[model samples]
Target: MSIWWSIHLRRDAASVPLARRLLLGTMETAGVDPDISYDLSVALSEACANAVEHGGDGDSAEAYRVTAYLDGEKCRIEVADSGPGFRPPSRPLPVRVASVEDEHGRGLFLIQALADHVHIGGKPGLGGTVVSFDKLLKWREDAPLIAV
Candidate 1:
């Protein structure tokens, strides 16, 4: 299997759904289990949404990139944005909100819950923030053969 699949897309609300769909399709093609597909999709969606919402500066539409890698029994996805990376919230995420509720702040927490490993750091090549998550493929004893 190939190590990476990558794309750069506009950082806007409209792009979020497309990004999610692309990630889901990639995972399915890579033979990820159906059981955890939704979880993986949701985590990628939330990660991309965060990058779009809090990414870059000014009114110019920024570009965000997503990269997926399939390595043996694990899959990794990285979402990056060209923005001044802010320190992650110090407190526990607000799982529920009051009458006047904030819809944000739950993304990182949710991503942590859904992924086997989550990492946040500056982008490798350019200057930006990148968030990565890895999912370990659960192999069933009776699983069919996987062609190399």
Candidate 2:
């Protein structure tokens, strides 16, 4: 069985949590485990946040789009925006300095580590950025299996 969903929201931090909840709930119905839920949510939130922060110019009407698909044993998520695309930074981001104690610049890094596959580039023929990730869903041997 395949499940798909799409959302468009104003580019802002407030929309991030809603996106996560929507994606996570959809994924649960598709058999994603709870342990991996946070990882998926974090990766998606970061990608969407990047799209909003970098793509949207703090305009309330600017729209950010998120699409999710579950195909059999794999799940894929894509976040896009109406604003212009950007080339991701090539160098590693500097760690938080002891004196600074900041909590930023870790989004892309977290996505790279969590996702089984990640794609970041300009959407073809479109100006905005599209950040896509795919994860391989794992099944617990002890849990009841459903054959679709």
Candidate 3:
């Protein structure tokens, strides 16, 4: 069985929780493990927050998009923004930060730690940035497969 959903929302703080809640509810209804759901939710929140913070040129018409896909034993999500794309780091991102007092810069680190696979890139036509991640789902043995 497979399931998917996608939504476009204004690039604002409120959209972060809305995205998280929707993802959480979808996972819960699909019988995903609570721990995995929590982890994914946090990662999704970070992604959405980044999009809200950096995803536009102050254009009210611009919006961010969040998409979720559940296929077999895996769940994948994508958060994309309509802002100027950033240059990808030439090397792999560090897993740890040097300072605890740093007020920011931890979102990508957290996302990498929580997700099983992550891909960050610019949208086609240099339109914006996209953060996409996937996690292998771990369902309880008693849980039945959901219909798509």
For all candidates, what are the clash counts? 0, 0, 0
- Residue range with the least summed lDDT across 10 consecutive positions in model 1: 139-148
Q: Which candidate is the best by lDDT?
A: 3
lDDT per residue as tens, model 2, 47-102: 98887788766686799899998777777999988677887556543544333665
> How does candidate 1 fare on TM-score?
0.80
Provide TM-scores for the models. 0.80, 0.83, 0.91
Sorted on TM-score, best first, the list reads 3, 2, 1
What residue runs in model 2 are displaced by over 4 Å at the alpha carbon? Answer: 89-100, 140-148
Model 1 lDDT per residue over 28-87, tens place: 665667766678789889988888887788444679998877677777889999987866
Tell me the lDDT of model 1 at 144: 51
Best by TM-score: 3
CA lDDT scores, all candidates in order: 0.76, 0.79, 0.89
Worst 10 residues of 2 by lDDT: 139-148
Candidate 3: regions farther than 4 A off: 142-148
Q: Give the Cα error of residue 51 in candidate 2, in Å.
A: 1.7
